[model samples]
Target: MQIKLIAVGKTDDSSLKELISTYSKRLSHYCNFSFEIIPDLKKTKNMDESTQKGKEGELILKHVNTSDILMLLDEKGKSFTSEEFSEEIQKKLNTGMKQLIFVIGGPYGFSPEVYQRANQKIALSKMTFSHQMVRLFFTEQLYRAFTILKNEPYHHR
Candidate 1:
């Protein structure tokens, strides 16, 4: 199955971008992988947080498809260990789903509509993280999950 990661806004730190790219490349070997970035909304100074979140949610939803499974990366979502995460990936793979889409919303977080549409919600940790930083963290974890599934040494038990 193809796995796609969709994150809001660009990464300003070149180092983080490079690292995210590195893990994304490693993911290509195990599955059809792609990373997508939704540009940040412009001129948000006048808008309220809810409005900005709504606009960002629209852009995020535009990349999704009715047939695709949408997973939101949110703080209040399910938390799993490395081994358990691999099992989640295995469970998704077994479904024969065409694609599994994961989204990292903007700073204001996801809108109510977005949350309603999501099939699953997952959290990397209880601690808060910047949206840009989450991209790299999530990508590496994804790569690590694949390695664990393959019985590779990348993930030590």
Candidate 2:
């Protein structure tokens, strides 16, 4: 299955961008992987939180397809161990999924419409993280999960 990671906005920090690129390259060795960045909204200073979220949500939805298995990276979503996440990925592959899209929303999180469209939600941790930082973290975790699936030494029990 093809795995696509969609995140809102760009990563301005050079270090974070480098790390994300590193992990993304590492992840490519195991499966078909791609990272997409949606441009940040303009003139958000005058908009309310919900309105900003709504606009970001619209951009997020535009990248997704009806046939894609959409998963949102939400704080209140289900958390899984490294091995368990690998198993979950294996299950999706076994089920013959065509595309798996995991989205990281904007600072205020996803809107109600985005939530309704998601097939599942996954939480990386209980603590909050910057949207840009989450991209790096998620990419590394994805690389680790694939290593675990391959029984490689990259992941330890």
Q: Find the candidate with the highest lDDT and give its number.
A: 1
Runs off by more than 4 Å, candidate 1: none
Clashing residue pairs in candidate 1, if any?
none
- The residue-by-residue lDDT of candidate 1 on 50-157, one tens digit each, is 999999999999998898999999999999998899999999999989999999999999999899999999999999998888999999999999999999998985
TM-scores for every candidate against the unseen true structure:
0.98, 0.97
lDDT of candidate 2 over 1-157, digit per residue (tens): 8999999999999999999999989988999999999999999999999999999999999998899999999999999998898898888778787999999999899999999999999999999999988999999999998999999998874
lDDT of 2 at 14: 100
Error of 1 at 55 (Å): 0.7
User: Whole-model Cα lDDT per candidate?
Assistant: 0.94, 0.93
Q: What TM-score quantifies how close candidate 1 is to the native fold? A: 0.98
Clash totals, every prediction: 0, 0
Superposed model 2: Cα runs more than 4 Å off: none
